[model samples]
Target: MLTLRSFEQRDWPSVWSILEPAFRAGETYAFPPQISEAEAHEAWVEVPAATFVACAPGGAVLGTYFLKPNQPGLGSHVCNCGYVVAPEAQGKGVAYAMCEHSQREAVGRGFRAMQFNLVVSTNERAVRLWKKLGFTVVGTLPRAFRHARLGFVDAFVMYKELIA
Candidate 1:
């Protein structure tokens, strides 16, 4: 079993382990593959309104995500999030739980909806999963993502309403 909780300073090591490989992959996220630890920490923890970690009952970290408003001022009603699961924990439903949890949490935090600014086209698994979770591909940005292995690829802007 796994549980979610607010990230703590002590959680850094565990969260960092999960974040490194995913960020280095340069597939799903736009961040550079060789991002430094301080930069990663600042973006993942310092910038987001809330950062969460998924942990096993015995305290092993399984995954992490950061939730924040998609924009400022008039656009702040929409929330945005990013997730990264530990490599060994892939295919085990960690991300599914995180998405479900984020939707509920977003509503509770007063967000009217959630949006994913860039879902890389080649990351078909994520696109499918977001659709399964009720998100829609509202727009496609052509050759928007510079995937490390696939060169330039299209990306989708996915969105889901949490209220109304």
Candidate 2:
């Protein structure tokens, strides 16, 4: 079983361990591959409205995610989130669980919708999973992401309304 909770200062190291490789891979997130720990902490923790961690039974972190407004002012009703799961925990349901948890948290925080601005097209698993979770591809940006290994690739703008 897994548990999700607010991020604590002590969770930074484990969160960074999970985030470092994925950010370095440059395959999914748009962050610079050589981002410094301080820069990453500022982006992942300081900037977001809230951050959370997913932990195993023994309290070992399995993943982390952040939630923030997709835009400011009138657009703040829509939120954005980024997720990263430990490599060892991949193929499990960590991402799915975190996503579901995020939606509930978003609604509670007064966000009416959620938007993923740059879902790299090459990330088929994430695309499929988001679709399964009821998000729609509202638009596609042609050659939007310069994937680490695939050069330039398209990206999708995925969105889902949390309330009618």
Candidate 3:
């Protein structure tokens, strides 16, 4: 069974194992492809309200996620998050579970909705998964993300209203 746990010092290495390739790929997230470990940690771990690890009974981390405000002031009612699953764990539903959990967690934390600001259109797996999870691509920014392999690609602004 998979379980979600608050980030701990021991979780850093495993978290990095998942994040590094994603960051290096520069495909999904906006982080610089060459971002260093400390820099990546500052951006991924230090800034979010909370970080979590998806762990197995043996304590192996399969994925990680972070939750934060989608924007400031008037936009604070919406939450934003990012997920990274271990390469070995891909296609096994780790991201889906994290997205579901994050929505519940966001609502519990008083967020009225959730927004994904820059979901790469080329990332069909994530786009499909988020849609299946009830989020809508309310808007799209053409050629917004420069996917490492795809050059410039469109990105979507996905949103889900959690309250009313």
Candidate 4:
């Protein structure tokens, strides 16, 4: 039984554990492969306006996500989000659930839209899932991400209107 909920400070360790691998992989997020744990922690939990975690029945975090204003002042109506799941939790609907929850959460946070600034093109699964969840590729940056082994790769800027 997995449940989604607002993140707590106590959840940082588990959330960091999930993010660290993804950030270091250089296969998904644009974060530097050698990003330090402290840096990843600050970037994921502190920089974002809100953080959330999906937890197992016993309260162990299985995945995490963060929501933040896409820009400052005039552009703040659009929000951005990033997600990562524990490797063990893959294929368990964690990402789908997180994305669904994010849509509602974004609207509640006063954001009219949600955008993903960089969806790595090499990450086909993620790109496909984002599309399935109503996001559209509004733009593409050629060779935007330097994948760990694939050299330079394209990235998609995915967006969805969360409010009508």
lDDT by candidate, in order shown: 0.94, 0.97, 0.92, 0.92
Candidate order by lDDT, decreasing, is 2, 1, 4, 3
Query: Could you estimate the TM-score for every candidate?
Result: 0.98, 0.99, 0.97, 0.97
- Model 1 off-target regions past 4 Å? none
lDDT of model 2 at residue 125?
89
Cα lDDT tens digits, model 4, 1-164, are 78999999889889888888888888998888889888887888889999999999998899999999999999999999999999999889999999999989999889999999999998998999999999999999999999998999999999999888
Worst 10 residues of 4 by lDDT: 16-25
Off by over 4 Å in 4: none
List, residue by residue over 89-142, the lDDT tens digit for candidate 3. Answer: 889989998999998899999999999999999899999999999999999999
The alpha-carbon lDDT assigned to residue 130 of candidate 4 equals: 95
- Per-residue CA lDDT of model 1 for 1-164, tens digit only, reads 89998899899999999989888888889998899999999999999999999998899999999999999999999999999989898889999999999998899999999999999999988888899999999999999999989999999999999999
lDDT of 2 by residue, 1-164 (tens): 99999999999999999999999999999999999999999999999999999999999999999999999999999999999999999879999999999999999999999999999999998999899899999999999999999999999999999998
- Badly placed stretches (over 4 Å) of model 2 are none
How much does each candidate deviate from the true structure in C-alpha RMSD? 0.7, 0.5, 0.8, 0.9
Cα RMSD of predicted structure 1 = 0.7
Candidate 1 C-alpha error for residue 3, in Å: 0.4
